[model samples]
Target chain A: ELQKQFKQQEEHAGSLQASMNTTQEEITQLRHKHTMVKAAIQEAKWKQANLTRRVLKLVSAQEIERKRGVPLDQTEEQ
Target chain B: LMRQAAHVNAWDQLLQQGHDQVQQLRLTLNNVKTDQSRLQAELDFIQGQQQELEQLIEPLEAAAASTTPAQHQG
Candidate 1:
């Protein structure tokens, strides 16, 4: 009876170890994916910053040109 | 016989601990995945905004480039 109980427990331990291995692997993959997502977010923020700066400069230049009363064709030739 | 029972009990305890660890790890993984999805959504939003801003800037850039030299001449 004791041997039987021991064998059952050994089997239980083996299964538990197997499940732990699988869970650890899943966690590792999740962490890697999280890192990639963070990097992408950083990249998107950088692009947004650059685009905003360019838009501001362009808008200001357009305003100055409007105030100067520059003719469209003359400006185009320039 | 008693020693064998003790050994089995120890194994049971270890297995229970292992199960708890697996459960905790699974919860952490789920949270990480959720965060990953949220960040992805944020990235998409920022990229979309950036695209719209770029489109708005294109015509302005063209008009500015054309006007700069005329401003200089005047």
Candidate 2:
């Protein structure tokens, strides 16, 4: 009887190990995916910054001209 | 009979240790699950932010394209 119970316990341990392995696999995949998403976010933010810089260049130039006595309405290029 | 009793007691102790091992494994699993949940939420939030950032950039890109040739900023 004791031997049978020990055998059962061994089987239970095996089952639990399998489950733990599966969960570990899922965690690995999720971490991999999270890394990719973070990289993509970084790329997007960099693009946004570059675009903002380009647009600001034109606006700041016009501002400098207006401060040097050019009228705002006249600064509008047709 | 005495030897059988001793053997049985030994097996019982081993079985109890097995149960304890199982309990520890389960707790570790629960912790992994919690970690998974937190990571998933973080991923979802960052993805949402990425979408919002992309949307905000669209008009800026259009304006930039129309402004002039890409000027290299020093």
Candidate 3:
């Protein structure tokens, strides 16, 4: 009976150890994924800023073109 | 039995530590998501402001165009 209990405890401890190892691996993977996602979000923000600048530049160019008395289609042709 | 008790105690401690690490990771993930959302909102706001500014400039641009040719021809 004592031997049986020892066997059971050993099996239980082994299972717990395996569970701990898997959980640790998963946590590490999740952390890596999180880092990647954070970087992507930052890159997207930079792209957004770049897009805003382009829009402003286009608007400024439009204003200049309007002042030049160029029709819209003619401006595009040029 | 004594050795088994010691093993069980150590295993339990390991489990507790693992749980704490998972909790910390979850918190960090939540923080990253929140930051992404806030930046997205700010981007939307900036786009809206840019549209408004562009709209305001349109009529002014037209008026300037109309006035300039008259000044040249006068």
Candidate 4:
């Protein structure tokens, strides 16, 4: 009976060790993926800002042309 | 006629990649928040699970002009 109990304890300990190993692996991968997502978010932010500034510059140039073409004085006289 | 009507340039094409930024946000949000049918894996460091996620996600959701969809699931 004592031998049987020792055998059962060994099996339980083995399974617990395996569980811990797998959980550790999971946590490491979790951190890796978390870092990746954060990096992607940061890149998206800068890219968006860069693209937006370019767009705004284009709009500003168009506004200058419009103001030049449509003089405020001419409209006021009319 | 198409050439005059269409102002296609390398700069314009480069700026068009901004579409990928939108897709990246969507993918990141989905990665953090699972939808439907089990299989939800959350960061263990944060306490109160979904509550912590709400705090983390609020700014992004606010920027997108969309309110939080999942109030509970923990």
Candidate 5:
């Protein structure tokens, strides 16, 4: 009877340890996913910033072109 | 028997804790997706606005170019 009880306890302990290991793995996966998501967000933000800068530059170039009364390409036919 | 029961309870508690963390992670991921989509929409809007402004500038530029030589001559 005592031996049976010891065996049952050992089995329970082993199963619990397995579950803990699985949970740890899940946690690690979640952390990795979060890191990837953060990196993507940062990349999107950088792209948006670059687009905004380009738009501003284009606007400024158009203004300068207007003041000079020149065509956008500024290569007149000879 | 009692020790086995105690281990089962501890295992249950740990599983519940893990479930809660997963739920929180899901919520955070959802929020991040929402923010990313919103920013993307805003970027699209700004791009469209820039195109329209450039289009409007074209006619004005043409008008300015057409009159420039005449104004210089006068």
Candidate 6:
């Protein structure tokens, strides 16, 4: 009876160890995915900043042309 | 009998540690998944904003390009 108990305990430990290994591997993959998502976010933010700058420049140019007495319709027609 | 008890205690300890590690790893995975989704949402927002900004700029750019050559010629 003692031997059987010991064998069962050992099997339980083995199963737990296997579960831990699988969980650790999953964590590693999750970390990789997190890193990749973070990088993509960074790239998206950079693109957003560039587009914002372009929009500002264009808006400011239009403002300056308006101030210089250029008709908006004339510019649009050309 | 004492030796067998000691062996059982050791196995129990090992099993408990494994369970704890697995639990902790699962929590970490959940947090990472949440973060991934949040970042994805933010990226999507920025891309949407970029599209809007580009749309706003398109006509301005065309107008600027159209005017510049006329100004130069005049």
TM-score of each: 0.79, 0.52, 0.52, 0.45, 0.46, 0.77
Whole-model lDDT per candidate: 0.80, 0.66, 0.73, 0.49, 0.63, 0.79
Q: After TM-score superposition, what is the CA distance of residue B51 in candidate 5 from its true location, in Å? A: 1.1
lDDT of 3 by residue, B1-74 (tens): 89979978886786688678667767876776787787678667767766776775677577778878988997
Q: Which stretches in model 3 have alpha-carbon errors above 4 Å?
A: A70-78, B1-74
Q: In candidate 1, list every pair of residues with a backbone clash.
A: none
What lDDT does candidate 6 reach at residue A53?
A: 84
Clashing pairs in 3: none
Alpha-carbon error at A48 in model 2, in Å? 12
> Candidate 6 falls in which docking quality class?
medium
lDDT of 3 at A25: 76
What is candidate 3's lDDT per residue for A1-78, written digit by digit as tens?
977986897688678668766866776787688677767767766766776677678677767866675676587898
Tell me which of candidates 5 and 6 scores higher on TM-score. 6
**Local error of candidate 5 at residue B65 (angstroms):** 2.6
Query: In terms of TM-score, how similar is model 2 to the real structure?
Result: 0.52
> How close to the true structure is residue B17 of candidate 1, measured as C-alpha lDDT?
84
- Candidate 1 lDDT, tens digit per residue, B22-70? 7887787788778778878877887888788788878877877887986
The DockQ-derived docking category for candidate 2 is incorrect
- TM-score for the second chain in candidate 2? 0.84
Instruction: Give the native contact fraction of candidate 5.
Output: 0.00
TM-score, chain B, model 4, is: 0.30
lDDT of 5 by residue, B5-26 (tens): 6776676576567657656765
Superposition error at A31 for model 5 (Å): 13
lDDT of 6 by residue, B13-74 (tens): 87778778778878877887787788778778877877887787788789888996786676
What is the i-RMS of every prediction? Answer: 1.5, 5.5, 4.8, 26.8, 6.8, 1.6
Candidate 2 per-residue C-alpha lDDT over B38-71 given as tens digits, one digit per residue, 9 for 90 to 100? 6567667656766665666666567567544634
Give each prediction's DockQ, rounded to 2 decimals.
Answer: 0.62, 0.12, 0.14, 0.01, 0.07, 0.61
TM (chain A) per model: 0.79, 0.72, 0.72, 0.75, 0.61, 0.82
lDDT of 5 at B46: 61
Write out the backbone clash pairs for model 2. none
Model 5, A1-78: lDDT tens digits are 556645765675676557667656765766676676666657666766765675576567557657765552366533
